[model samples]
Target: MPPPQPRTHKAKPPSPEPRPSSSILLISPENKILLLHRVKTSSSFASAHVFPGGNLSSQDGPIPAPSSPERHVDSPVYRLGAIRECFEESGILLARHRDGGGMLEVPDAERERARRAIHSGEEKFSEWVKKMGGVVDADALLPFTRWITPTSVPRRFTTQMYVYFWPLSGAGQDAKIPIGGDAMIPTPTSDGGLEHTAAVFQSCATWLEQARRNEIIMFPPQFYLMWLLGKFFEEGKGGAMELRVQREKVKEFLKGSGANGVPWADKVMSPVPLGMFEGRAVLNLDHPGPELKGSGRRGESGHVVQVRFSKEGPRDVEVRDAVEMKRLMGEAKGKL
Candidate 1:
């Protein structure tokens, strides 16, 4: 054999720096919360459930404020991004009147102008709020939670979660209302862009039940929030009025000791847990439809065939082959 060649070491590739993400959470005046169902066509996390929020933009930076808000402004970028996303995704503007009444009302014309400004890229949120006689009510937004996507994930966000309550009106209820609306009256809609396909109202109990039963697909933040909400409901004597009080307590709770217990930490384990699978099944079956195979079918298609094992017994047979005749017959009769 020839003399062994000298070993050569290969240089390791450089590790990529982490990217940050941000988001906002809005609860309507009706006590119904808002969430987004990501479109199946999305390039990132397609078909996954999410909130009405997004990553921070370059324009998301400090605005001159006469007084410092409750949140940190050193990175006003994150706050600004959160406010912008709240508007973009949920039609809830975390802004106040120039006089400081903490109310949001814009006429049709003004609403249109603001929308135009945002669309044209000429309107910065801070400047627009100031010009339109409004202030960024970052104080009203409660910093509920924060999350950093795991490094293993292809896409990530250093998301800051905020919760805010907004007034509801007929115009606000209009799902087609444009963001910022026209000057006559602010028309807030649930059409929160492609990132959100549907927005609906449900109580914390309802949300938890759905999540627990796997009726809805939610990410960590959403899942955690729902679990926390469930605890609040549980603590509230299981009544709507008590639940409302518990809802208000959330802001204080977040600022103090954080949620009583993080459900994700306590509940989520093993990538493929029974809870997650059950949730998936529930979400899949949410709509009106036939039950799954093992659940039993209804109607004329419910017939079952019985097979007898003879003395020749115990021969292995493929179910697919056995079902082929039945399948073909069903197809021929248009019963499949």
Candidate 2:
């Protein structure tokens, strides 16, 4: 008999931790949502139409106590980060005057200067707002949803999504504080083609249609959220909904739970991959990954979204039912 050899095992690589990040759906007074076209050279989410947001920074704020029920853990920081990133990426400051003058009103030249300074890290975001005699409208950002990147991905993030009703047409009667007029509405401008190429506002249906036709690229998250937002608008109505009325309807939806009694904000979505269909990745929003199964933390089921992956970026997003998704996946598997 040959000499016995000691057993050897290959160690598994450590899983990447999900970085805390925040994004905002900036809803215009006309009910359109702002979407930024990311630079093609960017490392992540390159060439995709995404919401304004970035990673949570240390200067955002201190984390909250985990046991606190009033607020989600690190939500204050997330909100601050979302506002800052929004300003940095789209030049739209979600801020109000400190003197209770509603939205902050400053000359366009001054706003651009401040934006440049903040983007260059020459000044801290919160300090600049305070110096300008304004306060960040953090509370304006309502908790919309949260997405956790799948474990299979090399780079991961825990992104907190929020919705901010930018009163471009003026704050509605339902608003507690009296916000200013059109002068206070900050215009959306790209960051000199640094990270974003353009900042555009279009109806959710328009964006969804573009994505469906492969005209623009939208990742699974943005695609799914836009689909949900489209429901609030009337089809073939020229996307005409008064600002006040739209704000009230959105507020009601955010306050109440979704299809079930469970609040949408409470849901921590981690879409589980079922299979593939026609070169597209099919993800199941109803079920979290195997690791998250029985965790009781992931919230209610939503929709099934698919995206065709490419070397440049993802494209051709579509929403389908579970049965149709399974059938497509089966056909794709058989083709292989």
| Each prediction's whole-model lDDT (CA) | 0.48, 0.75
TM-score of 1: 0.60
Poorly placed runs, candidate 1 (over 4 Å): 1-15, 62-75, 108-120, 167-193, 233-244, 258-336
- Residue lDDT tens for model 2, 58-116: 77876433233323333688999999999889888788889877776656677778878
Q: Distance (Å) between predicted and true CA of 312, model 2?
A: 2.0
Per-residue lDDT of 213 in model 2: 87
Can you write out model 1's per-residue Cα lDDT over 1-336, one digit (the tens) per residue? Answer: 999999989996442322344566566544446666667677665655566677666577643332333122224566677777666654556777878454655554565556556644688877877876778877666665455443344564445566666633323322233322221123344453546676565566676456544455555446555555545544325344554576667655555542223321111111111111111211110111111113221111111112222232211111112244345545655742
What number of backbone clashes does candidate 2 have, counting pairs of residues 3 or more apart or in separate chains? 0
Superposed by TM-score, candidate 1 places the C-alpha of residue 51 at a distance from the truth, in angstroms, of 1.9
Best by TM-score: 2
Each model's TM-score, in the order given? Answer: 0.60, 0.85
Score residue 52 of candidate 2 by CA lDDT: 98
RMSD of candidates 1 onward, in order: 16.2, 4.7
